[model samples]
Target: MSGNEISEVAKGFTYLEGPRWHDGRLWFVDFYTCTVNAVNDDGSIEEIAVVDQQPSGLGWLPDGRMLIVSMKDRKILRRETDGSLVEHADISAHCSGHANDMVVAENGQAYVGEFGFDLMGGADHEFANVILVNTDGTSQVVASGLSFPNGMVITPGGKTLIINELFGNKITAFDIEADGTLGNKRDFANFGEIGDEPNVAKRIEAATIVPDGLALDAEGAVWIANTVNQKATRIVEGGKVLEEVNTAPDGIFAVALGGEDGKTLFLCAAPDWDEGARSKAREGRMLATTVDVPHAGRP
Candidate 1:
């Protein structure tokens, strides 16, 4: 099976990321605008929340509350049923730089990742660990040695977790233990070469393949946003690039599988990733298309 033609669903956003499909709407955050929004099928927008420190990843707690990542401040915030926000957890001292992406399991355990270094500031590369936040709002390190872990997803059965390593050029997997902890860290998919240069800019430029955000299918394959390659590639467990969709003129940053049949693949993209440039313009867009497999994992 294969996807149909791609089309633009929404446009003129500021660096969209952490895309989630819920309740017949496409929800995502604009990095530069510092706001979360939901888009209707007709392209209308409904503003969700405004994060002063900038919002990155998003998840849903078991009780229906929304868990949002406050990037700059290193905090996880929960959105109540009444449209109010509350502190979920604080991970200020755990991450080296800003928190980036996260995934919540069936048990309400949120696995979060960070930049691991000053990526926008052009600082040296640093490996960061994944933090697990329990339902009670406490947090702890569950896995480590990840090279800029960006996006994450949990299998539908809730037994496995897979994540993207932005600079490592690979997708790593961890077995989810019964206690909601992660174990058996290993490469789920490995690309040819990683970004081994000294600085962030050079490293991003040198990478053969850069895995950013991902979407898992019913058949267990993952669709990856290959940042450096300017395309979205579908890969199997052993790192075989099965399909590639060029998102040129705009680099695909994140993805989500949804729609009536769950074949709709939402692409969050922009032409430039530089903070200064992207923040000053509304060039980002939310694109939608169909895929072979239906979505089979948690957001």
Candidate 2:
């Protein structure tokens, strides 16, 4: 799809990330604002949950309840019918880094990631990793030593799990076994620049370095929010660049396919880091775009 074919759906959100399509609307996390929002097709927004802890990933349970990741508290919260959030699991035990984004399977297994080292200032930074947490709260480290595990998706067939290592500029794939374990890890895509720069750290620091969100199209292609480039890139399973959708002022963290036909792409975007925070406090709107493909996997 050409860049012009995509247009903004809304605006003014603080660190918008983790877009998920559910029950006729687009649900996402406003990380800096500490709330989960639902955006309708008519462009109206609703604050569905107020999470004081930084919220990141969003998913649903087998019975259709909502599961949210509380990044600051390092816990998984389940939204109950009475409109209350309950602690489902304390993942702090297994998470080496703050919980970023996650994907839940049809069986209700959640795969969560962490920074492995302090990104926004923690301590004793270590290797980044992904952890598998069961519905009952049991957990285990699935993959380790990643640069920054951000967005993640499990294939519809349930055979593989794809994870985005933001700072590493690479998408990694792991074989998912029947028992919910991951293996055969390999790089799915390496988005490094063609020419090497002497000051890599300076270059990365200036760039968004990939941030926190991704989605799969109906055709099984991955739609990655390249925060550093301020564009959403569509890539096939083998890592072929199919298209790129650029955003205004360009600092988007997450995206998902929604709308009546699942062709509308909703973005949780911000102009930049500092400006994004201010906008979120003043106005909670987030941008959206129209894409050509339907959402992949379960909606």
Candidate 3:
């Protein structure tokens, strides 16, 4: 869809992230607002849950229980049938930065990511790890040596896992073993050049493709939040741009393909990434446009 064709389905938030289309609704988390909300098919919004410490990613368990990433506290809270939030796992001991996004597999295995360093605080850069949260509430570091792992998706058949390394400027993949372990780590789609600088600000200013959130299409193409260019770029297995949808006036933070026909490309956008400025205002929005390919694979 063109920039002019994109419509705002919902507005009035700080910063929206982790866009998920499930059960006929578009669910997401508002960072500064500290709320988990969903916009129904009728255009009415609903407050599904609340995350005081700040919420990022959203996923569902095998039995259909909601799993929310409590960012600052470094814990995964599971919503029970009675609407109570309980700690599913504590990952602070295994992480140096706040927990970020997560992807739950078909077998109830959840892979999560973190900053690995203090980004907002202007700390030095460091490679992060992907923690695997089992169904029994046990957590382990499944994959390491990542430059800020953000949004991820498991293939439709659950054989491979694709991850967007935000600070690394590359789309990486891992072979999902039969035992729920990740092996054969390789760059699925990598492009641009950020140089060899480890200085966070210096590298970010020099980076070419700073990927944030991403979604997989039906044809194996990946729609990524190209933060460096502030648009959603569609790429195949190789680092080739198939299409670029501009979300001007606002930067696209996340992309998801979901709707009745699964062609609705939902874009999580904001005016800027200034946490101080964003936290004081509700300028965040959930914009969307229809595309040809529907959503596939795990969110």
Candidate 4:
């Protein structure tokens, strides 16, 4: 699919995040609205669950349950069959910042990222990190000293994991061990140099790009939501930018590959103003494009 011909799937949301193809529907989060919504194949939208805390990320357990990332309360929430939310994991112990986006593995292990420091509005802080949480309720920090870790994905073979560092303007990779541990951290792709000149880092909010929300295509390419630039970019295995698809003027927070054939790319975009005038007007909206490949790994 060419970037010039991509189309929009749905709109009219406030701060949308965490879009995943589950149960034949498009499941996502509206952070400002504090609700989890699903867009059915027939184009009908439905609210699936609600949480007081702002939901930032979404994932599924091995048994088909949903795991949501709650930012305000700093917790991972699990949605029960009866449609109630439960404390699946408390990550405040290892996270200096709030929890953001997450990716789950086949063994039921979820890799979550944190703001490390307040990026949105809580506090002026720094340092982002990644943590590992199991379905059994055990949690641990797998990587640290990161500058606002955001989006993440485990490769199809499950041998490696890639994370985006918002302030760093780079994608970092780690070797995934059989026990769900991370090692050998290295830069996978560098969006641009980190210093002052209006580059990738200066475009998006700190820790909003590199790791905001990400998806993997069937060809093993990583589709990154370029938050600052308001675009979706495809990166090959060697950290090369293959294509860049422009989105709305708002910040592009996350991206997901879904659709019947898994060729549709969904984007979670939101409006963000300067700190002092931060108001939620048109906060979240869903943008989409058609791609040539399907989503990699499990949906």
Candidate 5:
């Protein structure tokens, strides 16, 4: 509950990511296992949906239906009331690589990002686009020229959107326009000094602040999951580190603030989630810790 003290809540998964707290439960996606799952307070877990190509982000439409990011095929799938999965939007043609994470708005619109290159094959870096998928199943490239945009969130007032660029080593901010377009792009926080590393994979490996996922707190600060160093950092908009927590054996991919009082910080973590390694083992875990500030903003 204080000073990096954390306890295990759930375990046995093949790489967990895109965690969220919705409907009084914690929801997440197991990338290698290809399933969307939920865990309740009673230590019971339920499979909510299955994604053949794998799933990442989790959110809900204004109508209460669920929206899932189908990573491989670059599609967003929506679950209906009767538990049927339907294609909401196709972003395969728009993205340079596999889609990763998303943030759904209260109006049912979503902003999604992709890898921007063949990462596993060790391809070089290529800027990716953040696609805006409308509620009616139409899509458009809202923001472009990003270095692997990963986790994202809309501010509590819905006026700003913050996105974590994994390889870029910074969190980018955008002004949310009325028409669902992103503008006024700027660096919200600089986790560390990023240099020109010709090798994309090596850049990520060398960077100390390789942020993956993010969670906004009521104090207007963001908690970042630094995948490279296996640490979680709480930083303000101008990049001041307020607090940090370390996960030694396993690395954290994503985080969510949830619980009865919204004080629990749930972390999605696993032991080295490279494609070859994670596919062969199920060592993912959901860890939780208490914090002083409650959650704020969207999932």
Candidate 6:
């Protein structure tokens, strides 16, 4: 499998995000359309659920229920067997901004992150927390003071959780405790230095990279969607860039690995996240390519 020879699997969406392969289909959310859908192998799509507040991430609990992230409402939603959406966990009281991506563990624990500030409103950058939601829907702030913590994945062994610190230009790892709490925060990969600027605007502008969504491979390397660089990068431990796929013009905001053998790399791309342009053109597409390694660990 190589980064070249890209293929378009789906189109006509207003910003696609939170790609996950489950039940032999590609599941994702259309941000502006407010729908969670699954694309089958034959190019047909099925509407699974809808999020009125906007959706960004998707995962599943151990009991086979779907979990969705309601972005603006800062809550995790569970889709019951009756096709109803209910609040699984409300984390708004502990978050400064919108709830974003998430990863569900083997034991049904979910680790979700937030934007940490008014990103679209041009407000100052502030650190946010990662909320851990138990199987029963109880939630707690397991890790905090993070710079825009975005996509996350739990290791196969269920001992570590890797998070993409979007504005921090790095991937951070945390020790996942037996009780579902995160501790011992450390850098897993550092792409570059984040500038120290009093002005929040300048600080963000100085960032060399912004890692958004990520997917872990069987070899322990993570394929990251670089928001600022407009590329999908494969990075292992120690900050090494093993490979990169250019998305140019359109930014690759999310990535997922899955297919019959779990080697297909799915990408979510749009010209930009501007609501005005995305809603008008609906140019978001789900592009894919095969990779050398198969997907591993939790989604």
TM-score of each: 0.96, 0.88, 0.97, 0.89, 0.97, 0.96
lDDT of each residue in 39-98, candidate 1, tens digit only:
876779989999989999999987888999999999999999999988999987788899
Candidate 4 residue lDDT tens string, 125-158: 4666798998787899999877678788888878
| Local error of candidate 1 at residue 13 (angstroms) | 1.0
What does the lDDT read for residue 5 in candidate 5? 84
Tell me model 2's lDDT, rounded to 2 decimals.
0.76
> How do the candidates rank by lDDT, highest first?
3, 5, 6, 1, 4, 2
Model 5, range 46-150, lDDT digits (tens) per residue? 998999999998789999999999988999999999999999999898988999999998898999999989888778888889999999999999999888899
Model 5 residue 52 CA deviation (Å) reads 0.2
Report, for every candidate in turn, its global Cα lDDT versus the true structure: 0.86, 0.76, 0.88, 0.77, 0.88, 0.88
lDDT at 142 for candidate 6? 93
- Model 6 pairs in collision: none
Per-residue accuracy of model 2 over 15-122 as CA lDDT, tens digit each: 677888888877887766788888766778889998888888999998888999999778889999888999988889777667878899889999998866565552
RMSD from true fold, candidate 1: 1.7
Compute the lDDT of residue 153 as modeled in candidate 2. Answer: 86
Model 1 misplaced stretches (Cα beyond 4 Å): 1-4, 193-197
Across 140-246, the per-residue lDDT of candidate 3 in tens digits comes to 99898898999899999999999998888789999999988899999889876564567976767766677888899999999988875778888999788788889
Lowest summed lDDT across 10 adjacent residues in model 3 is found at 192-201
In model 1, state the lDDT of residue 287: 86
| Reference-based TM-score, model 1 | 0.96
